[model samples]
Target: MAAYYSQNNPDPSPTSLTFAYPQTMDWNRELLRNEPGMLAEEKLSDVERLKVKIRMFARFIGMKGAETPRWEYERGVEILARRIERRVRLEEETEMRRKVFMGPRAWQA
Candidate 1:
């Protein structure tokens, strides 16, 4: 995995991996084509959460609007933040398990 390190190391932090962000989250792609989930259903869960976040963000940014005054921007922002936190936590847990299962060989692989 030297290639991964070489490319990923340009940025020191884990969040530096822009691969996980939008544009990469292509929902139309078939199930087998995407990265496998950490947990059995994690991939599906993340996709749904991401869709919600994207829609909410669009509304919060006024990219879309509804007639209702009760659904405020701050509320939408909060939902997006919560979804991000959940996704990150699940991803980290998955990474930890992968590292454990592969042990030192994880780096070599």
Candidate 2:
């Protein structure tokens, strides 16, 4: 048992571990500085929210070592936004056609 312990536990003293921590005052100052901006996200429109999400996703993908260029992601987001707009337009047109077919009663319904 002693031989096994000596072989496996040669320097069993607890090692001093150093952790880097930001000064508490600096951390609190930075958090206070950005607090209002964090709250502003709740006021963004649907499209703006989507754009923000896409931008965050692009950043995450870039961090993951993706070879795709930034412009490509931006272009793709623009194309997606245009498609969404077109779809909304078509839906509005369809609703208008239904209203016309259903006569003035459609408005009451």
Candidate 3:
């Protein structure tokens, strides 16, 4: 129709059309790019790692001990002591398992 041509295309000659959103490059490339900053390269020490785990567990359980300590001792000696006890038990269990799996030969060694 004459009205359609006039509204959509003026002059009727062949011309290149431009898209609103061009797809020349990937959008996620910039997002996936990693720039190193102050992040720690090495893993945390055993004490530090255990403390983090214990704190997370306390938060999950909604323990009031995390918010306020019963004792006013500095550096959370009580919490640290509990963490050490748990770690020792885990180590003992691991050693027992290793010994059991290895059988009588382990006892000889």
Off by over 4 Å in 2: 1-66, 102-109
The global C-alpha lDDT for each of the candidates, from Candidate 1 onward, is: 0.51, 0.49, 0.48
State the lDDT of candidate 2 residue by residue for 8-83, as single tens digits: 3456662332222211323232212234434332233446445545555555545554454565456556655655
Per-residue lDDT of model 3, residues 1-109, tens digit only? 3343343555555334322222233312321222354123222334654555565467656787665333324334644565567779989999998767667787799
Q: How accurate is candidate 1 locally (lDDT)?
A: 0.51
Give the number of the best model, judged by TM-score.
2
Which ranges of candidate 1 are over 4 A from the true structure? Answer: 1-71, 102-109
lDDT for model 2, on a 0 to 1 scale?
0.49
The candidate scoring highest on lDDT is 1
- When summed lDDT is taken over every stretch of 10 residues in candidate 1, the lowest stretch is 25-34
Clashes of each: 0, 0, 0
Window of ten residues with lowest summed lDDT in model 2: 18-27
Quote the positional error of residue 73 for candidate 1 in Å.
0.5
Candidate closer to the true structure by TM-score (higher is better), 1 or 2: 2
Clashing pairs in 1: none
